[model samples]
Target: MPANAVTQIPAAPADEAVRHFEAELRFETDCWDTHEALSQQADPGFVLLDVRSAELYAQGHVPGALNLPRRKIIASRMRQQYPAGTLFVTYCAGPHCNGAARAAAALARLGYPVKLMAGGITGWLDEGFPLERDAAL
Candidate 1:
C-alpha cells in the first residue's frame, strides 16, 4: 500500500507537536479572537495596528485599529505614542500580504511585545465583522 501525501512525511511526536503549536499561539492571533477582545473587553490590553498605507486604511479597517504604515514603524514614534511594554497586534491586507509580519517584526525589534493577526483584513471580513470606513490617522 502506498502512503497518501499527508502521511508521506512522518508526523512529529505528540509532545513535540504540542510544543510547536503552543509556541505558535504566542506569536499569532486570529480575526475572530481579535474582534471579541476589542468589542467585549473593557480594556483589551493590546493595541491593534493596521499596517497598511494610509489610503488603504481609510478605505476600510478593523474597528479600533490604528493606521500605522509598516514603513513608518519607527522606534521614536512607537515610544512617543505607546508606553513601554505595550502589546501590539499587527495586521495587513490579508494572509497574502506580508505587511502585518513586517510591522510585528519592527515592533519586536524596538522591544515592544508583538503578535501578528493571522488573517488580517481578509480574515476579518470573512468572519463577517464590519470594517470602519473613512477614518484617517
Candidate 2:
C-alpha cells in the first residue's frame, strides 16, 4: 500500500477534535450563517465589515456591510462608530484574500470582539446572496 496524504497524519482524538472545531466557530462564520443572521434578525448583534479597498467595495460588497478596509480599521474610528461591546465580522474579496484576517486582527488588537467571515465575498456570492453597490463610507 502506498502512503497517501489523507492518512499521512493521524486524525486528532475525538475529544481534541471537538475542542478544536468548537474553538474555530468562535473565530469564524460562514456566508450562509452571516446572511441568515443579518436578514432574520433586526439586531444581528454584530457588525459586518467589508475589508476590501474602497474602489472594490464600491464596485460591489455584501449587503449591509460597511466598507472599512483593513488599513482603515483605526481604534478611534471603530470606537466612535460602535460601542466597545460590539462584535465585528470581517470579510474581503474571498479565500484568496487575507484582508478579512488582517481586519479581524486589527479589531482584536483594538480590544473588540471579531470574527472572520470564511470565503468572504466569493462565499457570499456562492451562497446566492446579493451585493450592495455605490455604498457610501
Candidate 3:
C-alpha cells in the first residue's frame, strides 16, 4: 500500500448507490424535519426522547424531548407508560455519543417505533435551535 495510492475496495452500481444514499439522506433529513416540527409545536405525532442522563437533560435538551435515560428504558416500562405504537426520536449528546443508538436499539428490540436523531443535542445546537431547560437554568 503506497502512501499516495488510492485503494478502492468495492462499489455499488451508480444508480443503486444513488438510491441507497438518497434513502439514507432522506432518513437523516426526515429526522430533522420531524424535530423541527415538534419543536415548533406544529404536530404532536411523535416523541423526542433524550437518552442522556438526568443531569444532562436538566442542563439542556430539545424543546419537547422526554428524558428517559438509555439504561432505564424497558419493554415493561414503556408498555406501562406510553401506548403500544408510539413514534419516538431518541437523541443524546451528539455525534460523539452513542446514547441515542443505545436507546433506539432497546426500543427497537421491544418492537417500538424509534428513530435516532442524527446529531443529538449538538446537531440541534448547530442548527441554531435553542435548548429548553429547567427553571434553574
Candidate 4:
C-alpha cells in the first residue's frame, strides 16, 4: 500500500442507482398484481406451488397448490412433473424463507415461466385467501 497512490473505488452514480431502483420497483409492482390477479382467476395456466417441505406443506398451503418442495425442484422427477413452459408461482412459509426464490430460480433455469409469490404463504393467508390441508397431486 502506497500513501501517494490514490485508489478510487467506483460507486454507482445517483442516477444509475435510481434507475436500478425503479426497475426493481416495477418488477415488484408487476409481480404483486400478477399474483393477485392469478389468485382471483384460479386459471390452470397459473400453477401455485408450495416450495416448503412436505411436513410444512401438510400443515397448511394455498388451496389447489402443488407441493413441490424446493429440495426436489432440481431433481429429475420433479422437473418432469413441472416441465418447461409451465407458468409457476412459488411460495414458502414466509418472507424470511428463500425457498421460494430458490424454487423460482431453478424453474427459470429450466425454462419455465416462474414467479416468486411475494411475502409467500403468509401474504396469501393474510389476504384472507383460503388454505387447504394435504393437497392431492
Candidate 5:
C-alpha cells in the first residue's frame, strides 16, 4: 500500500450483493413484458388482482382477473385467502392510479410476493389484451 493511495473495500458476497441490488429496486418498477409473460404462463398459484373500485371494475378489467378492491384488501383477509408465499399481480385504473401500489404494499407487508402491474388496466387495454365487462358472479 502506497502513501496517499486509497484501498477500496470489496462489496459483500455475490448473494448479498444481489439481495442488496434487488432491495433497491421497487416492486412496481417491473415492465409490461414481464407481467404479460407471467400472465401467459397462467400458473395455478398466480393471481391477477384488480384493485380498482367495483364501479370501475364493472366498466372494464383484465380478463380472468379477480376484483379485490384496495379498500377491501385487509391484511388478515388477504393472508387468509392467500397465505404468506402466494404470488399476486395487482393492477388499478392506469399508471396514474395509486390503488395498485397501495394494494401491492398491503400484500407485500403481509409477506405475499406481490408485483404492481406497470401501467395498470389502461396498459392492459392499450396492449389489446382481453377485457371483460361486469365480471361473472
Candidate 6:
C-alpha cells in the first residue's frame, strides 16, 4: 500500500448484512401495516394496545385498541382476552412520543410479544382510518 493512499474498507458479509436488513424490514413492515390487516385475522393472533392515559385514549384511538399504559404491562389486569401467542401492537400520541417503544419494551420484559406502531396514532390518523372515542371496557 502506498503511504499516500487511503485504505478501503471491505463490504459486510452477505449473510450478515441480509439478516440485519431483513430484521429491520420485518419490524417496519409490522409497524406500517398495523391497521391494514389487524382486524382481518380469522384467529386474531394479535392485540392493539394503546399506551396512553385513559383520558387520552378516551379522546380517540385506533378502533378496537385497549387502553393499557406501558407502566401497566406487568399488572396483567388490563390485557384483553387473547391467546398466549398473540402479538401486542402498541401506539401513542404520535411520532414525537416514545410511549409506543416504551410499551413494547415493557411488554417484552413481562414476557408478552410486542411491536411499535410506526408514527403512532398520528400515522393511523394520517392514513384516513376511522378512530373510536369509546374507551375499551
What's the number of clashes in each of the models?
0, 0, 0, 0, 0, 0
Candidate 6 TM-score, C-alpha based: 0.74
Model 5: per-residue Cα lDDT at residue 74: 86
Where does candidate 4 clash, by residue pair?
none
TM-score of each: 0.96, 0.93, 0.82, 0.67, 0.70, 0.74
lDDT top scorer: 1
User: What is the Å distance of residue 54 in model 3 from its true position?
Assistant: 0.5
How big is the positional error of residue 13 in model 5, measured in Å on the Cα after superposition? 21
Question: Between candidates 1 and 3, which one is better according to lDDT?
Answer: 1
Quote the RMSD, in angstroms, for model 6: 5.3
Residue 70 alpha-carbon offset, candidate 6, angstroms: 1.2
Each model's lDDT comes to 0.95, 0.92, 0.81, 0.74, 0.77, 0.76
Q: Please write out the lDDT profile of model 1 over residues 23-107, one tens digit for every residue.
A: 9999999999999999999889999999999899899999999999999999889899999999999999999999999999999
Query: 2 or 4, which is superior by TM-score?
Result: 2
For candidate 3, give the lDDT of residue 81.
87
Judging by TM-score against the true structure, name the best candidate.
1
Inter-residue clash pairs, candidate 5? none
Give one digit per residue, the lDDT tens place, for model 3 in 46-73.
Answer: 7789989999999998887889998999
Task: Supply candidate 2's per-residue lDDT for 111.
Answer: 93
Query: What is the per-residue lDDT of model 2 for residues 99-121, given as tens digits with 9 covering 90 to 100?
Result: 89999999999999999999999
Q: Evaluate model 2: give its TM-score.
A: 0.93
Per-residue error (Å), model 3, residue 37? 1.5
Model 4, which residues run further than 4 Å from truth?
1-44, 135-137
Error of 5 at 23 (Å): 6.5
lDDT of 4 by residue, 1-137 (tens): 53443445555899999999887653232334545676668575767788898888888877777898877777577566756677887888878889888988887777777777777778777766766786453
